[model samples]
Structure formats: structure tokens, C-alpha cells
Target: MSYLRFDKTLLTNLEESLTREVLRTNRSGAYHCSTIVDCNTRKYHGLLVIPVPELDDENHVLLSSLDETVIQHGAEFNLGLHKYHGDNFSPRGHKYIREFECEKVPTTLYRVGGVVLKKEKVFVHHENRILIRYTLVDAHSETILRLRPYLAFRSVRQYTHENAQASRHYDEVENGIKTCMYPGYPELYMQFSKENTFHFQPDWYRGIEYPKEQERGYDFNEDLYVPGYFEFNIKKGESVTFAGGISAIDTASLNDLFTYEVEKRIPRDSFKNCLINTAHQFLNKQGEESYILAGYPWFKCRARDMFISLPGLTLAIGEVEKFEVVMQTAVKAVYAFMNGETTDLKVYEMEHPDVLMWAVWTVQQYAKMVSREAAKEKYGQLLKDIMTYLADGKHPNLQVHDNGLVYANGREKAITWMNSTVNGRPVVARTGYIVEFNSLWYNALRFVADLFVEDGEFSFRLNQIADKTAVSFIDTFLNEYGYLLDFVDGNMMDWSVRPNMIFAAAFDYSPLDAKQKKGVVDIVTKELLTPKGIRSLSPKSGGYNPNYVGPQIQRDYAYHQGTAWPWLEGFYLEAYLRIYKRSAISFVERQMISYEDQMTCHCVGSIPELFDGNPPFQGRGAVSFAMNVAEILRTLNLLAKYDNQ
Candidate 1:
């Protein structure tokens, strides 16, 4: 049996199946995502979504969906599903699905009368293309396959309607046609592996609703254009391939190309392999530079997320070369920011208060995973520069105090990762001496000191400052309740019980002693820990909101209040194992099992961004998150180390 397989009982149920999505990416900022039953439930769902760098930084949906109809003796059976206005689904293609499995690729089997058809979908790597192969498994009579292309040539963030500005003209290519809906966008080429006749019947399919967008309190209605349908005869035990891409290709090589791409896929046969495969999807290689996308469907290359996810996404998977390559691009951006120069790198928010600290920590992880000598040889100068910049108060938002701690001015903007805002004001304005920032600050100083131990003068200065920061960190954050406060600003101590304190215990050079670290861990285990992950805020706190649902504003309010973030669980588990040692291995293993069910939920074979903090924690936010996947992989790597010992 496949690791991720859904039978008829689940596939035919819209409520359960629609919640499960499948995502395929080409490593170059293009992706194909949709529901398991081939329904476009969200505006982000598309068969071919690629970034048009000429127009803007955002991704555009070129081909929204492809509707397939199997004709037997002139009787047509549409295998396409779409949600119309008023909770109505047209074509109802889900009913014909017998099985859906995603091991090598997304494969679905359908049964219609005397025909059994198998459909497999694959997204070509490093190319803006999607190939789907259709095979007639068994048929007693001749069959004709009709494919209708639904084009929504617009930004994924926006919807399109019927307009005269859209060119109705198309250019005929080899065994296909190429058309451009707008002037700036790239032309979409629809082609077939074998000879097929194209019929031009352009019409707008209006009022198609995206229920997921409507649930999030946004405009959900859209209009998709169907230019024409391609019909071809099929014989039993024969296969035909369809290609949708930004550029035209040789029709004769389509079959060979599909086979070559499928051969590169790593089968999702186990949980670990599934996560490894998911990790590869987040890597975006653009020419000489590489970046780790924060999340799927919407997020871009963010500095904080890139560093936080780098170690696990690459180093933990034994891809040291990739780790260094991505770091080469990121280090350049970091150097440009520190030197007061602008860079053309596509990475954003390079000046986040703790981004430099996180970058140092990521390097520290590389040193730990590979060797200190390797890390020092490659990133020694970069680490020295980052430390000098931070210690001298060179950062715009970060300030070094006399007490040897870093203070951030987050009141004016959402500087930290809890960056939700309303009306230009931060929701959680944690201004002074954030707990995690100080922890990371101390860790960075000590790590650099250890790496460059030969430099006696620099090492001594960093240790002296680290000692002072350690003394101040315990005095300021550790409260009477045996837990650390979230942040401290003068007399206004934000006493919200949060997962930020986990870093104080999880880091390699933690300030807190053994007993102190245990006190911090105990409170977190009692209050914020859940099956899904560590809650952003303790439920005992008055400001806690458990459900991340409702309208946009409401969801933003709860985004970091009590939403359980899977990424935080990595730190919590690491801290637990650090304090309890070998005795905690069984507990950590059980906690890892809690996430096994997630491999089949939300987005199959991957993890989501956040989950509801309450019972029956439903996943919320992005379908697949890089930080969540990376952290989980890191935790798995940690577990393996303990097992080997």
C-alpha cells in the first residue's frame, strides 16, 4: 500500500477530500497545487502557476485547470470538478474517482462504466511546466478523451473577468497552440504528445467560487476562460501525455520527457522520505543565487525564515553543498545591509532585528552537523563581521544596552516574527529586550568566540559580554512562577507565557543553568505544550485565543496568541531532550508520532504552518510551510543521533 492513498470512501466525500491538497513544485518558483479530487478550492489552486519576473515578483496562474471528458460511443463523462456560486459543484468529477495515491507522483484511478482510466501528474523540475499522462487501463470499446483548458491568466492574488482587453487570438504551434491573455504575461503553450485535433470554442466560465477564500472573508468569485478542447482517440493499454508550460516544446519528445521527470521523483514510501521530498520543494534556484521560500502558495524569500529553515532543509539532510550555496547568496545580502549598500538580491527584510542573530545560529548548526573546522573555514569572516556589527550598535532597529543585551524598537513596526499588524500598529509590540533575541544574541557571541579561539583578544571580549548577558537574561526574564516572561520593557513586563523561553533551554550556549533550564521547561510543558505543537501563548493567559478562524482581522489577532506553531515544537522537543537526557527519548519519540497523522492531513506528505490550539486542532494558514518542515526534519535528525548513542 502507498504511504498516502485515499480510497473511494474518502475521495467521494467532499468535506474530507477537499481539505486534503496536493502540491508539486519545479524548484524555480513554479508550482501545481489543487485538491486531491482535482478541484480548485482556493485562488492559489492551479495546474500551472509560475512567476513572471518581467511583470512583478508575484506568481501568476496561467492554466487554472484542465477538464477531462471520456467519451464512449458519443456519451461524454466529464472528469472535472469546480465549485460554482451558492455551494454548488459542477461536473462532479469526484464521484468517478476510485483511488488517489501520491507515492512517485499524484496518480488517480477512475472507473466509468466499462472503462478504467489512470491519470498521473508531474511538474517538471527547474521549468515552468506541468505534464499529465493519461492511460486507458482497460476498455472494452473505443474511447475518446476530450481535454478543456481553463485559463486564468492573472496574478494569483487577483481574479480576472471577461474583458475585451484580453486577446482572443492564438498562434498555432506544433501539435498545439500558444496564446497570451495579457501583454506583459508570458504565452501559455498547450500541447499533446500525440496527434490531436483542436477545436476553438472560446467562452468565459463565470461565477466560479473559491470556498476557501470566502471562508477567509475575501472575494471568492472568479471567471475562467476556456479557449478550446482537444479531442483524440485512445486504445486500451495506450497512454497519451498532455503538456502545459510557459514555452513550447517538441511534441514528439513529450512522452520521453514525462518519463525522465518521473524518474527523478523520490517515492513517498515513508514519513522520513516524505519530509525529505518536501524539503526539496522549498529550494528555489535562480541562476547563480539560491533561496529557501518561506512557504507555499503565497510566501516569498524572507531573511528570518530562510535562516531558521536552512540548517534542517539542507544540513540535516546531508546536503552540505546546498547549504553552502544558499548561504553564499544570503551572506552577500547580509554584507550589503551591514555596509549600508543596496543589493539586487530578491530576499526581503534583511534588516529584521534578530535576522543576523538567526544567521549566526544557522552557521552554528552547520558547524555542529558537519565540523567546526569546515564552518570556520567557510564562514569565519562572516561571523566576525556580524558580531562586530551587532556589538557596535550598527543595526537600525537593534540597540546594544550597557547590560550586554540587545533591545529592539518594535513599537513603531512589527519587527519580530510575531509580525501581524492592524492599522499600521503592531499587534504584539514586544519592544525592549525580547527573550528569544537575547538568547540568540548570547548564543551567537559564544559560538563565534569558540570558533575563533586562536584570536585571544576577540575571544576574551565576546566571553566577557556573554557573561554579562547571561546574568541579565536570568534576572530580567525569569519570573517568580519559574517561567520566563515574553519580553521586558522598563516596568511594563509582558508576562504572557509563550514558547520564546524554549530557546533559553534549546540553544547550545544557554545562559540558564541546569535547574533553571528545567524550571523554564517544566512550565512550558505544563501550559503551552499540545499534540500539534507548542502554543504561541499559554491558554491560562487572559489574552489567549485558541481558534485561528473567522474574518481576516480576527485571524490576525489569533495568529500568534494561542495558535500552536509546529516550528516551535522543534525547539521545545530539543529542550526537553537536553534537560532530561536519555530518559526523554521515549517521550520525544511519542511526540514525533503525534505528527505522523499530519502526513496524511491538510497537505498530504507535508506539514502546514499552524494549527488550532484547542481540541481537534485543525490546520490553518499556508498549506505547506518551510519552517515547519525543516524543524521537524531537524528533530528527526536529533532523534537519530540519540538512538545511535
Candidate 2:
């Protein structure tokens, strides 16, 4: 269950990261652009991919575009970009972004496509057909590439009710969408393109055939529309620039978000790799080091991203250079926090803010996987600095808990990465205190404590803190159902089974006995496991549903609850190996190591956002994600090498 170090393959990717173009995929299913600046030529080159939905409805194509900048109610005052007279969707103020409504058709919506970032922020200044550039971290020595995707919609209408009439008259037009240049970075110019061929979907549910691309040809949810595609041009080798579709805006308001991507994200180029060449048109970016927590496009920032992805992506692939870059990034983020920008309460978020205990724990695990005594020493200091920060109490009036869990926030709400919103309000605030963060805290301290117990500045106090936390965790978080509550309070707020416990089992630092660990694993496996991976919740839960693909609004209702997610599979498999004490993996492990190859067959390589809750179902994908591939590779390491190790 320990994190695995990177290998030659990962090192190759790391070297590539220095000169690689970006393959960016938003939540919506579209390839906005694939951009690269040839190192020899210094020409910014890019390919924008727009996957035609095989759905009979042509408008389904635009589903991706609308999702990227779909308009929402009342948001007009803030993030929405205004179109024509008064409509708006903007990327600014939309990081922690979730969904957007389909205008012509109420049933449809768009989501960003996938997860993966290989290079730093490479901005483009594009006007007319001529493209210019901004800033980039590596173009000086290595080639740089950046890409963005968009899906056009053709099917604009959907059933108002589950079994209602599918017939509705609607018009598709370019409402107010926002586009712009990176502020102060004149090399990058941005603009939104209105599709001339928007209406391509049938009025009703129909399937599609993709003769142009043989690898793809299928229908997910009969009701679909022509998807939109985002086009971006980066003049070769400039400075760093960022751009993305925004949701919610007015002409003036929407226009304001032109600087959304560039202004918000920090430039980063920690690592790289390119084993993956294509994604279900929606997702084509390869797996590298990625942070999928707080923002839509991370122009260039590191912290939670530096930590969360360290194990599965970085270490497993042996991206030592990236290892150093992310370590530096994490340290810088901690410094930024101490200097006053990051909030202790908000730092763990993948998109923004302070640092996360989970990240700290991940670093500890990553250190073990990396296994170099010197690297361990260097990161040991980094971990020690983090503990010092925790002891300093990272926020206004915040202090360490009795158990050494950092005082996350004083507010009773405001969840971190697992954040969910209903009607634009954080539904799970998860403030005041939390279980998983502390579990990570305890494990991280233990891992670090064990690292240099007899060496310099060792926190033997860390062990005492972890002990107290372990007792508190067992006494407080256990539920009557014999399963770990998703989280805890005076009364368990979530009775649903979840994969969060894998962190404990994987780390083996939590004071869990064989029984407790097995109990946690068993409960989750029995309650949340599906053929694909772990479900966010048990099917018996109220929100559980087997259907995975659908229109935007309805999809959210049951999403994560019963949807079979592949990202959690690696953790689950590792937990299985750890629990069963499998010294030598079986043939099953060998076959499953081909998880990516198998998953690619679905909707054909689009590793969906999640699979349907039911069996005998496939291709219900609304989004293509990167974590699944990364996790698969992680699992592959376990079977092909790590288990043997």
C-alpha cells in the first residue's frame, strides 16, 4: 500500500514535460485545443478537437460549449458572460465550477472533459487567424504546447419531465460568452467563436455513427445535441497565458472574465509524459501530474496538486524531476500561505488556498516510494516545515486541536475538495472540524516521525499527537452500521460508505487494528464496490441510481452516490492487496493491469466521469477524466512490479 517510486517511463515523461504542449480538457466533453510550440521552429502549434456526438441529435455537439459557459440564473450579477443584449457566462469566479444549463434545450448541459496537465501555462494571443504568445516556463529550452477543446450543440431540447413530451421548439444562437487576452501579457489575445454550424442534432433521441473516427461510434443517453469546440492559438514561445469558457455573464459582465484563466492560475511545469495519444474526443490529454480540486484551469499554481497526485501519477511513473518541482511547488505554497495569501481553511482545496493535511500525508507516502535517503531528507524538512506551520495555527484565531489536527476553519460549513453545491451554495460546508483531514494528519506525522525519529529536529510529539488522534477517530467516527461514516459530527452526517478510508489503510499509520482496518475495507467493499470501482455511496442510499449519463440537472441528483468511479479503483485494489496480504498478485492482477486498455473500449477510451450503477451497461459517459488512467497505471505498478517488490 506504500506509494511507488517513478521508473524510466516516468522519467521519460518528466523530460518531456519540459518541452511538451498542453492537452487541456474542461469538464465539458470537448477538445478545446492541443497546442505546442516546436522548440526548433519556435512556432506555437495547436490542434482543436471537436468530437461529433454519434447521437442522432446534432445539437448535442454544442453540449460541451454550453457547459463550458452555460448561463445560470442570478449569476449574471457576478460570473455569467452577457451575450447579444443580456446573457452572460464567465470563467472568473467559476473555479469550484460544476454545471451549466443548456439554453435551447432545458434537459441538456455541458461539463469540462477530463483531468491532465503536462506543461506549464503557455498563453496565446490570437486575433483573426494570426496567433501570438505570452509567457511559458520552459519554451526557452524546450518546446511548449497548450490546447483547449469545445463541443458544439445541435440537440437543444430535452424532456421537461422524465416521461414527458420530447417535442419543444427552441432557437440556438450565440448568446453573450466571454473571451479575452491575458492582462499585461500582450502576446496572448483571446476571443469566443460562434459556431456557424450549430444545429446538427435531431429534435428527439437518436444514435450516431462516426465514420470519420473509427475508434469512436456510440450514443450515451439518446438525447444529445451538437457539441461546441473551443479554438485557441498560442504564438510560439511567448510568456504564460490562460483562457477558458465562463459560465454566467452579461455582455459587460461576461467580457470581464477575459482575464479569467490567466489572472487566476499560477504558471507551473512540474512534470510530463505522453503515452496517451487520444481520448474519447471529449478527453485526449495524457496523464501526468494533475490537481483536480479547486479551479477549472490551473494557469499555474501548486500545493494540493503537488501532494494529491504525487503517489499515483508522479511516483509510480518515476518522474523524479517533477518530484522535485512539485516538492518545490508545495514548499512555495506553504511559504505563500505564511506570507499571507493562503487561508488555512481553504488551502487543501485542489484549486486554491492553503495546504492540506492529506497532501502532507501524500508527501510522506511519496517520500517512501521515492526511497532515496537524500530526497527523503530534503522532503523531510519540507514535511517538518509543514508541521511547524500547523503548530503555528494556519488561520485567524485557529489553533491545533488536542489531537494535533490543524484547526481547519471556524465556520461550520465550506467543504474542501469533496465540495458539493446545490443551486450555487456549498451544500456540504464541512467546516468546524473533519475526520479525514485529521486521519491524514495523524498518518503524515507518524510517517515523518518514523522517517527521522533519531535524527535532527524529530517531532516525537508527533507520535503522541497521532496516538490521541487515532483514539479519537475510533471512539468518535465509528457508526452503528459497522462502516466508516463518510464523515462525522455529534451524529454522523453521512451514513454512506466511501473510499476515504483507503488513505488510512494505504498509509498504515492510523492506529487501526487488523479488525478495524478490515472492517473499514469490508464495509466499503460490500456497500460501495461496483464492477468498475468504488461507488461514492451505497446503492441503498436514497440518492442511489444506476444510470450514469443524462442531462445536466438530473445527472447531479444521483452523481457520485451510486456512479461507479474508476479513480477509486486503484485505492480499492491496493487496499485489497494490503488486507489480503497478497505477497504475489494473481493473474487477475495481471489482466486488470490492462485497466486502461479495457476502459478505453468504453465509449472508446473516454474513461467516463463514472459508469452506470447497474451491470450490463456501458458508455454512459458525460465526461472523460484523467485520474482513472493515472490510477490504472498506479494499479499496474502494483501488479507488474510493486506487489513483487
Candidate 1, poorest ten consecutive residues by summed lDDT: 422-431
**For residues 1-645, what per-residue lDDT tens digits would candidate 2 score against the true structure?**
101112223222323311222334432323232211211100111222222234431111222222222222212112111111121223322332232111110111112222111122212212111111222222212221222222222322321112233222233324312321112211112233222222223332222211111112222222223222332322333332223322222323322333453353322211112223221111112122222222111212234533554565555666555556545545655666656675432224332323456556666656666664755667666677667666566544335677554445523434454444557654444543455665667777777777767754556677777777777777666666665655554443665566666656655576677777778878777777666767766777766766644444455555555767776777677767777766437733643543433321322222444676677534343323445545665666676564556
**TM-score for each model:** 0.99, 0.55
Tens-digit per-residue lDDT, 265-288, candidate 1: 989999889999999999999888
The C-alpha RMSD in Å for every predicted model, in order, reads: 0.8, 16.9
Best by lDDT: 1
Residue 143 of model 2, lDDT score: 28
How many clashes in candidate 1? 0
